[model samples]
Target: MKSLRNLLLGAGILLLGSCNQAPVSAPAEPAPVDKAAIVLENIMTRASVRSFTAEPVSRETLQTIVRAGLQAPSAMNKQDWEVRVVDSQDKINAICDIMKKANPNAQDRFPDKNSFGNAAALIFIANEVSDQPGAFSAVDAALLAENIVLAAHAMDLGACIQAGPLRSMESAEAQAWLKSLGFSENYQPMLVIPIGHPDQEVTAGQRDASKAKFVE
Candidate 1:
């Protein structure tokens, strides 16, 4: 019995000696990402701004925003979009007048009361209306508009997507205005986006999972 016990203890010691451990692995570090760059997942999380400060947006910055807008995808790669940057105070006031006259009730609905109010610049998206089958140009123009808004927010600028300015003109008036503003007569205004420094901070709306549904 004593010999058997000693043999068992020796076997246990030998088993323990054979069970050696490998080296421990250190955790891998994550790669750094640019904080300012727009990520697709968070793109819709940004806010739309209407109010703006008296501070002006520089021409260089405006160009950057427009360039970003132009990067949006268009059907057939036509990229058939034209942008008009209205920086003149007089033209802005004129646009406001047109809005007021066109929509008499706009004063009550849009009480802030002006196109490009205190806005450093207004971005007008246009496309050749005759070139599309049915409002395709306008649809392309809208895509560009949304891109401009996202780019504006990413660049720390405030932007307001407005429908008032575009609705004020009839076909004739729109064509005339387009021609007068140096755009081809065939091009029609699709969106009027006002860009400037934000006077008040805008908080984005909370994500509503129910608002978006996926289908298999």
Candidate 2:
């Protein structure tokens, strides 16, 4: 009987030791990121970049920016907008020449005759006149234009919207050039977006909050 009691006590001690052993655990996952906050921060930090490096923007990046522009809201869901992406230096130079010819004094108004920062590409937003009236189409194009710039900024690319190029498209020669760039005669260029890797840093200007009055 003494030997049996000793054996039982030894078994109890081993069981207690096993119970006290540390448990095996699975690896922990990373914390969830706040996507909305990230997007809002991107919007706040966006600035108009007028100067750019010589590095060209890739086709994939340009397509992504265009996708973002198409995601913008349009009037009556008509989506009356067309985009023309011009990346060729020759084509850009031709357009710039037309601009200069259209307005001989454009140089005085703009720092560069191109007014596009000599970006890797130029995105021209035009209205699809058949789908909507000119006034409504213009508003729709403006919304799309903002989306394009914001998308470019989000992707660490610089972009600027200049009226000089679009305004120059009003001339007869400029209109002919537009047709050569694949824009239809019915479509009217509303905005010109120049995109590339930025060469200079830009700071946001101050806004007057008082100018915005809440009716409610």
Candidate 3:
């Protein structure tokens, strides 16, 4: 009976000791994300790419980039624009041919030889050519184009904003290709962005600080 009492007392002492122990501390929270700096860095570091690897950009990624572009602010929120993403090698080749054909009559259109950067895809931003649009369509489309290139840069993809395509798109030889977009007689091409995995690393051009002045 005495031995049994001793064992019971030891067990009780152990239980009390266990209860007296300090509680476990909770885990530290993860660091808050500094998205502002990241965005600023992206803007500051983004450079226009001239060449691209043969690796094809997935349609999903293109869609995501275009979706990001759609977030741009529009005049009166008209958002009257259409995006055509061309990733097909065959179609892309055809378009390249068309670009060359259209520029043939021009005074100085890459006179030596033609080069299209061999990009994985071309994203054409077209704004509606409406007589009475509720707001400024060109400005809205331009804003969206800015959003697109920035988003592509953020995703590690490179893009070049080419206004040169505007002339090509308006050429007679481009009618067939434009018709294929199903936007015949209504939309006008504003900008075409070629995007892909960058093969060439271009340095950012120097900014004219004098152009930007401190206002009182």
Instruction: Provide TM-scores for the models.
Output: 0.71, 0.79, 0.79
Please report how far candidate 3 places residue 82 from its true position, in Å: 1.0
Q: What is the lDDT of candidate 2?
A: 0.83
lDDT of 1 by residue, 1-216 (tens): 999999999999988877765556887788788765646634765687777777878889999989988988887877778999988777777656665566667543235636455687889887876733544676778889988988888788889777766666654644465566677667766778988887667788787789988888
Q: lDDT of each prediction vs. the true structure?
A: 0.76, 0.83, 0.83
lDDT of 2 by residue, 29-117 (tens): 88999999998988888888877777999899999999999998997887879888989978987877877777787663236535577
Per-candidate clashes come to 0, 0, 0
lDDT accuracy of residue 141 in candidate 3: 88
How far residue 33's Cα lies from its native spot in candidate 3, in Å, is 1.4
Better of 1 and 3 by TM-score: 3
**Reference-based lDDT, residue 69, model 2:** 93
The TM-score between candidate 3 and the true structure equals: 0.79
Q: Which residue pairs collide in model 3, if any?
A: none
